[model samples]
Target: MPRTRPLPSNDYARRVAGQFISISETRLNTSPPRRLHLNVNILHSGFVPSAWRLPDADPRAFIDVAHYVRVAQIAEAAKFDAVFLADNASIADQIDFRPITALEPTVLLAAIAAATTHIGVIGTASTSYNEPYNIARRFATLDHVSGGRAGWNAVTTADLGSARNFGRDTVPVHAERYARAAEFTSLVKALWDSWEDDALVGDKAAGRFIDTSKVHPVAHRGEWFSVAGALNLPRSTQGHPVLIQAGGSADGRELAARHAEAVFSAAQSFDESAAYARDLKSRAAAYGRGPEAIRVLPGLTTIIGATEAEALRRRDELVDLIPWSYSLNRLAGTLGVAADTLKLDERLPDDLPLPGGGNGNHTFFHATLAQARTHGYTARQLIRALAGGGGHRVVVGTPEQIADDIEQWFKGGAADGFNLMPDALPDGLQDFVDGVVPILRQRGIFRSEYEGRTLRDHFGLQRPVSPHASADSGLTVNA
Candidate 1:
């Protein structure tokens, strides 16, 4: 006899959550909350390079509300754990080559929230350009609007172009940006916790709605922000939106160690990923947090096909869709080298060096080079295999092969979960949901069903306990 737990149905939303996640025995034989978490980072207008041209793809997806709605619906139908959106404060060099879905992320996610039900909504916002109170309030509103399914991807805008947008001539130095980020995050969280979880008494008969005595101010006098008192909104359902960070530098890792509940990272190999995970966990221990407190999710972009040959050909086709000049400029911009210096077949020029005076983005440059050398690729072949500027690792294969790769990575301790981005929207994602997902279930790796409601629950993260507590609680622990 299988024991059944109540699904997080909309009807039972208050007692459960506004999600219909059912907890039951998995075919993989897993119990509650052990099921794997999956989040699709919906790269604006879809992840595919030619998504806008697909038969079902909306030609105006880059700016159409319905286009965004359609994609979110697909993810919801597939029972994905969440949908993520990324943002930049300003224009980048590649807008001419590609369409930018630069709609305000919070507004966009709010639209997404209204368009779909039961899928987590994550939006990227930079602490470098945003004030803490505004960010805190915006995310809080989204959480309430979405019935508790909101997440925030905290970022320190790295591109120099973003500084001018924020009324600065240059981006702040990496460490200074991170320093502000840490303080910014801490103050924002304090605001979220300013009012006790049960502060909203809702005592309609008594004509009292809030317990003012239970609320306090966050008088934070930090170097960058001096916020006082409470956040305008009450404590969100998740306590605070789940904190996700996506920088892979040393300072980035340290910041994640201190605060992030999940990490979005890029690593070329299993060994590198495993080591990086180990280092992050060690750092978390320094902050008095356990390994379980944070999750590491690597970017995994997959191109699927019924046959391995077909998959490879599909990947080749998309690479061909991108203009050579465009790919070259992108690679050049990232490599900190001129487009003229790079050759189609020659080894990387001896003069090519790292950026930011040694605090460069090592992950991409090294990952690209490793692919070229190990795979014996020419410049064209390398760029094509790299997949659309090749920021994340690219995998193309039959469904079974893709599942095998993911299973190995998961079991190998290289990642707790994967942040999937398809080469194109809808179709790219459709193949994954229809193909790889089933095989992963057969292999006893990915989940066939949801085991919990909230995104935090999906990730097996506990609700954040209040920092404000009875004096007796802290004293008793100290004693």
Candidate 2:
């Protein structure tokens, strides 16, 4: 016989203090305690492309497992929800002077998960080149190994460089890529649900390890992919790992609305971020999901110092290290414009065209433009403001000021939380953890200790019930 633990009874007599507060009572006087979710981006060296130039920066950090493990440990200690790793199939930047995304994400995240016990491990995988079954199995395996602390950042590779690496000279049109992505995502979910929760019987007396009748075939035949059946693995602890999306285009938004539990956004200002949050929630509503079902986390890059002047000096050191030619070319690439068209001292072109013929990364392009136009920053100033030559918002300040900025954004409905991209790693993250996290905790917007075991628990998301189980039981499953 299989030994099982007894279930808890609803007995107020045994309730612990501060553990059974009623939602209505708490909501009457003030909003329920709002938690600010944070995820660290473990990019090479750090967000600053020129960070490797620093004497203490490890150039080999791009491929070093120790480097990633240390970062994950720090983030876990700070109670961050997850550690995100972005990837590209092809070298998308000028690698002669800097590092590119070296290791594959799923593999690296497995390593990170092995070292850390709590932090969610998120890895990017493009639907353009990979099959839905493979992604389903890979993430499910990670979830099993990590004890349900896995998340998948679904993305469509947009750069022509990536397409060429896969034997295609030209990238797919924007609509086609997203259309395929939508189907691919749906199929993966179906595969995950192919097995009912109780499919694993493990009945030693009956000589049965699994209830085969409980497992069903996905039977998905789509335009992009035709997957035949159920995933080899059983249902993961979290049911399915959290689904995260990061794109700023219309199609991207629609995809996220229908499927994503969290959306990683690049909005350069409070108003922009607020509008984006509203738009995403509204879109989710259209798909029958409540606003609370999805979290909007805008990317934030912080350059911290003891004083404002010291912070600016640190920012300058990084920007100055990046050559004008490299910065200009990099910025142009994000804007989908020619490098020669931009002048370092001049403002961005008034009528800058969208890159990839409307299929490019609209999120970054729009966010970058918003920041540049709002501040009237010159090309050089814009480059410095961007810090890492990416479109994510960058702030330079003391601990207090940085904490204030984070609070303002969270309270103002601009963001549910932030996806932190520190200017440099280990040290940059350590500064934020030591200096800024205390302020956030004092203000009562961040967690001091992890409250749950899985990534879904950290994000306040429910563990999904298998659709097959719901069907078998004649119950409906909600997103």
Candidate No. with top lDDT: 2
Candidate 1 local lDDT, 311-381, one digit each (tens): 98888877777778888877776776788887766666654566565444555666666667666776777
| TM-scores for every candidate against the unseen true structure | 0.89, 0.93
CA lDDT, every model vs. true structure: 0.73, 0.86
Scored by TM-score, the top model is 2
Error of 1 at 284 (Å): 0.9
Error of 2 at 444 (Å): 0.5
Candidate 2 per-residue lDDT, tens place, 1-479, comes to: 11222213212111311122232234324644779999999987899999888989999999999999999999999999999999999989899889989899999999998888889999999999999999999998898888889999999988998999999988999999999999999998898888766667665555767678778988877788888888897776667799999988889999999999999999988998898889988999998997678989999999999999999999999989998889999999999999999998999999887897787888889999998999999999899889857799999999999999999999999999999999999889999999999999999999999977788878877666666653334333555
Model 2, position 21: C-alpha lDDT score: 22
lDDT of 2: 0.86
Off by over 4 Å in 1: 1-33, 54-56, 358-363, 373-376, 471-479
